[model samples]
Target: MPVTARHLIIQGRVQGVFYRNWAVALARDLSLSGWVRNRRDASVEMWVEGAAEAIEQFIAQAHEGPPAARVLRVIAQPVETEGFVGFEKRPTA
Candidate 1:
C-alpha cells in the first residue's frame, strides 16, 4: 500500500470539545502516524500519514468529529509525508 498524507483543518465548534484528544485516539486506533492540535482560531488541525484507505476513513470520521463538535467544515489538502511515529495530541497553536 502506498503511504499517503493529508493536512486537515476542521472548523466550527471544535475547540474545548476534546477534539484533539479524540482525534489522537482515533488516529492511533487506525494505526496512523501524525499529530493533531487545536488552532487559535477555534479549529482543529491535523496531519495524518498512513495507508490511503485508512486516510480516507480517517477523513470521513473527522468530518463528524466528537459528539460535542459541530463540524461545519473540513478542509483537507494533500501533503508530503513527514515520517511521523505514533499519533499525538499537540498543544494549541
Candidate 2:
C-alpha cells in the first residue's frame, strides 16, 4: 500500500553536490509527492508519499545519491500523509 515517509540522508561530500535536484528527479519519476532539501549539516532531507515499493526504491537511490555524492546513512520514518504538492528542492534549513 502507498504511504508517506520522511528520509534524512547523511550525504557525505554532499555539499556543492546536486543531491537535492537528483532527489527531486527520482521522486517525480516515481510519481511521489513531497519535497527535498539540503541541511546546514551537509545532509539531504526528503519526504515522499506514494506506493510503498516506489518509496523504498527512492530510499535506495538516496543511499547512493548523485554521482558526486557519497551517502553515509539514511534514516527513514513513516509519516501520516504527504504534505506537499510536488517534488521540489527546498531552501536549506
Candidate 1 lDDT by residue in tens digits, 3-93? 9999999999999888888999899999999999888898889999999999999999999989998999999999999999999888889
- What lDDT tens digits, residue by residue, belong to model 2 across residues 1-93? 646566555557776788888888888999898888778888777778887898888888788888988877888887778466778888998
Alpha-carbon RMSD, each predicted model: 0.6, 1.5
- Position 51, candidate 2: lDDT: 79
* Pairs in clash, predicted candidate 2: none
Cα lDDT over the full model 1: 0.93
Poorly placed runs, candidate 2 (over 4 Å): none
Predicted structure 2: clash tally: 0
Candidate number of the best TM-score: 1
Best by lDDT: 1
